[model samples]
Target chain A: MKLLLTGSAGFIGSHLAEHFLAHGHEVIGVDNYLSGQPRHTRHLLAHPGFSFVEADVSMGLPTDTGPLNWVLHFASPASPPHYQQHAIETLMVGAQGTQHALDLARRSGARFLLASTSEVYGDPQVHPQPEAYWGHVNPNGVRSCYDEAKRYAEAITCAYHREHGLDTRIIRIFNTYGPHMRPDDGRVVTNFINQALAGEALTVQGDGQQTRSFQYVSDLVAGIAALMALPGPHPHPVNLGTTDAITVLRFAQIVRDAIDPTLPIRFVPLAADDPRQRQPDITLARTLLGWSPQVSLTDGLTRTIAYFRALRAEQQPVPTSGPAWMRGAADAGQSAATPGD
Target chain B: MKLLLTGSAGFIGSHLAEHFLAHGHEVIGVDNYLSGQPRHTRHLLAHPGFSFVEADVSMGLPTDTGPLNWVLHFASPASPPHYQQHAIETLMVGAQGTQHALDLARRSGARFLLASTSEVYGDPQVHPQPEAYWGHVNPNGVRSCYDEAKRYAEAITCAYHREHGLDTRIIRIFNTYGPHMRPDDGRVVTNFINQALAGEALTVQGDGQQTRSFQYVSDLVAGIAALMALPGPHPHPVNLGTTDAITVLRFAQIVRDAIDPTLPIRFVPLAADDPRQRQPDITLARTLLGWSPQVSLTDGLTRTIAYFRALRAEQQPVPTSGPAWMRGAADAGQSAATPGD
Candidate 1:
């Protein structure tokens, strides 16, 4: 099968690109690198099955990508800080970018998959949000650019499916963390890992009591692949994340223990419109795809730490050789982790 | 002052254009007649201060409107039946039409007032929704094209205000009914009035217990004018409807009594995603704009009934003349009624 993957230079997108290539599928990757770094996809450049295009999906996809079996749209700024900085861009990407992707799918008769976020359920009043839950969202708040845009994206996607009978799927991705994450991306897991590696105090927002369910990147990739392979149009949004939730403070502690156990924690004010807790009710995913997150948090964190440590070593003025395991993880450019950014 | 009004041939927009013109403001009216009827603005065409342009707002505004003092975006099909029929068009008008209006405002340095709806609340989980309430909306539902589109309009309006320092105001209009409403428009007030005038059974949705706060079009026009006149960018969304609520059954009876006292009634299944109850918390409107709905329901309904009666009389084969009072109300087109469509 051949696929067109948007945001292919970003963390989750790169991982998915690699996963699909490994499965003997030819992938055409596209990214403008607004929030995505080129280094994330540098490893995949040599792969025979992968080709890359530099372009904004909001404008239009490259015309010469040939026919596609699947169009995966994952091209928006996922983190709060990044989206807030590029508010208008984020809104446009969600609205116009999704439209372009859907158009591509409709023209090619390819199944379209939209990477909708858990932020649609803004500060969710319902625990373990199901796909059936109508989200409580502030359409004009500080976070409205991302939240409302994603909501609009979902609405338009479903519109295409209903009006044109286009095969479309939406995956409401929860908190994901792993390698290829930009250190300054301002997601909790990356923040904790970076602060721990630098031997600085980890900053905990508010009381650090707010919990978030983290999904390993590999697990999310698997779930997404399974969703793409489903027959016919699946218009309903499906939740894709692990249920093994942990408090922010506990997450920081786990990162600290993996790096340096003596790292201190600093408390700070929480960002505006931040969710208190978000855990996906994956009953639909389990029933339909027979998929569940397999990687444990401990193992995921260990591999992620090794990757970040190797990155820090490479950035040093006098590069110090890291341990074989750490070097191996970094060289392979693969980790059983997820992206929280 | 010079103003540009979209959807100028529609119920609320026509009244607003006349209101602004009466207040010594020059008005350029634009409408695609998607849901708007050109006859509603026929009277205003002779007025020196009013001009009309035929164009879809979702496409673009009239280029020769000159410098705009205010851009009032009241376009899009408001009623359920019309919007659901043109679902994609409604969504595009809300998103792209809004963007075009905001761009016009930004270029001309005019204050923008978006005619948002109470539908944004989307089956409110809270009673008498305040400005601060985060709406409960199903983004992928059938009504999402309208509900989410309006929500996205608000978000983009606010985004322009915050990011570009563009002056913008949002008015969440509740159920409005008045003269010049399209009789076939599928709203409770129009449905009831038309059914009564045609000597047909009034169709009530569900148990007829669902309540809606009806605001006279004149009242809404007054509030919208007041909002546009306010200094600085008032980015917060203000509710612009009366707090006095009435059940659907009561509304139907009021119409029945005004038209034919013995009109039969029929109950039907409620439309999908219909709001159960909607009442505005207008404390902000009271404090900020010093605005309130002055027209009572009984008086408004009487005026609306007169207008519909005259319309029916005009359509008769024998051309029987309506009562002098009804003819006078229809001629003036200045009734203090509201639109439920």
Candidate 2:
């Protein structure tokens, strides 16, 4: 199989590209480093089947690419601070970028998959959100640039499926964390790990009772591979995430224990519109794809912490890192806007 | 004020065009005739202050429209059947068309007013939705093409306001029925009026107990003018709709009585995802803009019916009309996707 995978240097996108390439699929990776790292692309560049395009998907895909098989749209600044900082660009990538990808998929007669986020659920009213639950989303909030854009991407993906008979896939990925994640993308998971490793107090926002369901990236890629392997026209969005709900404080303790047991955990005020609890009802994924998260929070955090610690030893910073909103946010490190708390 | 308005040949666009023309503003109107009527443009062409540009906004706006004080983006196929059939176009206008409009607004240093919709609330969990209500919307549902598009439009509008410091105004219009609506735009209001006048049975989808707020176009125009008249940089969206909630059955009876009391009424199964009740929480509009609906239902229905009657007398079909799905949707004649149930 051959594929055009966008945002291929970003956290989840890079993982997805590697998975496909390892499976012997010819991969054309695209990214403008809006929030992606060069290291990931540089790593993929060593692979024989992987080619790269340095372009913004919102502008348009490369015209010369002889495409076949699939088009995966995974571009956009997914982190809260990144999207908020690049608000218009985020909206454009979701709106126009999604359209351009769909158009390419249609022209190439390739299956299309959009990298949607659980943020579509907003500060969900339902504790465990089923794909059937219409999301509760604020259309003009600070996060609207990301949330509404993903919702719009889902809308247009369905439109392409219905109108053009295009085979389309939508995955509403929940909070996911793993290796290859930036050391500081403003997500809670990374904030805790980096703080613990650096001997800084792990800052827990609010009382830290708020819980988030975090899926390991390997598990996420496994679910995607399963979904992609299935036959055509499964356009309904599928939720892929761990069902085990972990409170932010508990997760913070786990990260601190992995690095230094004495790392302090301090409480701070919670951010506005922060969800009290968010977990995915993954019944459909289990029933249809025979998939469930295999990696536990402790194991996932251990590996993620080791990766960041190694990067620190190398004296290299995370690539394309946005503003330093993370210095105090010992929150969920699953910040890449890819999937989050 | 000199202004640029897209969808000028549209139902509400034409009304808005006339409103500004009467106020002595130079208005350059753009429409691709996708869902807009040439006759509406013909009427406006006679006015010295009004000019028409034939173009699709999703493709791009015209280059020759000199400087502008305002950019009003009101384009798209709004009715359920119309939008569903032209699903891709609707998505483009809301996504790309909106961005294009915003770019021009930024370039001209003009104020931007986005004609959003109450449908953004998407079968609201909150009755009389306030501006602060986070909507319950199915991101991939049938109506998503229109609902999510408008939601996307609002997101991008806010992005422009926040990012480029572009002055922006957004009005979430509710069910507005008045003159210049297409006879067959498949909205509940016009369905009853046209059915009654043609001596056909009024088709009420369901027991018709579902209620909807109906605002006359004049009241809507007045609210828009108010929002536009405000000083620089009020970026938050304001609801510009009538708060009087009217049941579908009662609305049908009103339209029937206005045309002819002898007209028959029929009940059928309700459409899926149809809102049981919807009305605006207009406290903001009243408090901020000193605006309130002045047109009573009886008076508004009578005026609307008279206008359709005159159109029928002229023996000219509503121009640039789409499919004929309005035959049984007596749910609202306030079709055309401008604003409806």
Query: After aligning candidate 2 to the native by TM-score, how far in Å is the CA of B300 from where it should be?
Result: 1.3
| Tens-place lDDT digits, model 1, residues B104-206 | 9888878898999888999898999998988888899899989989998999898898889888899999999888788888899999988888899999999
RMSD of each: 5.1, 7.3
Q: Please, what's the RMSD in Å of model 1?
A: 5.1
Q: After superposition, how far is residue B63 of candidate 1 from its true place, in Å?
A: 4.7
lDDT of 2 by residue, A46-79 (tens): 7999999999999999877776898999998988
List fnat per candidate, in order.
0.76, 0.96
Stretches off by above 4 angstroms in model 2 are: A316-341, B316-341
Candidate 1: residue A50 lDDT (0-100)? 92
What is the Å distance of residue A38 in model 1 from its true position?
A: 1.7
> What does the i-RMS of model 1 come to?
0.9
Candidate 1 error regions (>4 Å):
A63-66, A317-341, B62-66, B316-341
Q: TM-score for all predictions?
A: 0.92, 0.92
